[model samples]
Target: MASKLTMTPGEILREGELEKRSDSLFQLWKKKRGVLTDDSLRLFSGTSERAKELRFHSILKVDCVEHTRKYVYFTIVTTDFKEIDFRCTGESCWNASITLALIDYQNRRAVEGFRRHRFQRAASEAEEEPESPEQRALSP
Candidate 1:
């Protein structure tokens, strides 16, 4: 049986607490360590077996709000309208880290998608092109 703890193949980037931030107030919920890779965020719960994942390609936007030297609040908005929120402990830059990671992931995905699309279009054009008369005349 496959374990539910299985994570996608990649290096872990950053990890920290999952918190709720309201204006000047900051509250820490479960200490969720976020593993950021080129494609996703895998959050392993510190107090439970629960895990949450957010894929960069599926994320429509990341909204980050910085408050006075104490905290940085951020939200991950997915294409499916799911909004996940988190906050950084005092002076910690978890929000910036997550935002940068997401941006890098998204850019990489976009480049790869563009390359694939270009390659496919080129291949399709080659296939659909009519053979030249000179080449046809030389065929057996």
Candidate 2:
């Protein structure tokens, strides 16, 4: 069955609580590690600065999930900004480089997902085609 609830970039952005939700999400990402400290803000600030410059703050939709090995994956969608997909797997909050890397990775994942979904639709259409008359003639 086709999903009635289709999410659009515009709709996600128009939501009133996006910024609050985004801040909350960042907090959750930090809380998941069970330690809240200045180091976390430092790491977040650096990452967010780069993201802001890259326009990630204009993001429309953001999704995050915890992977099997204590890693958290983040997916984000934006207007002029490209989609980001990344995973964080550092025990120490002081690892700013790793945090930045994960952010970049997540951005890549969002772009990849867009490409993947398009390819999947095309593949599904190709697979359901009826046999052509030309092919039947050639076979005989």
Question: Over the stretch 17-125, how does candidate 2's per-residue lDDT look in tens digits?
Answer: 0111135455432322111221111112322333222233354545554444655465555556655544455342222433443354456667889999999999999
Question: What's the TM-score of each model vs. the native?
Answer: 0.73, 0.27
Clashing pairs in 2: 84-106, 84-107, 85-105, 85-106, 85-107, 86-105, 86-106
Worst lDDT run of 10 residues, candidate 1, spans: 1-10
Off by over 4 Å in 2: 1-103, 138-140
| Residues 46-102, model 1: lDDT tens digits | 666676777787888878755667666678788998777777675777767777777
Candidate lDDT values, in order: 0.71, 0.41
Q: Candidate 1 regions off by >4 Å?
A: 1-9, 20-28
Give the per-residue Cα lDDT of candidate 1 at 47: 64
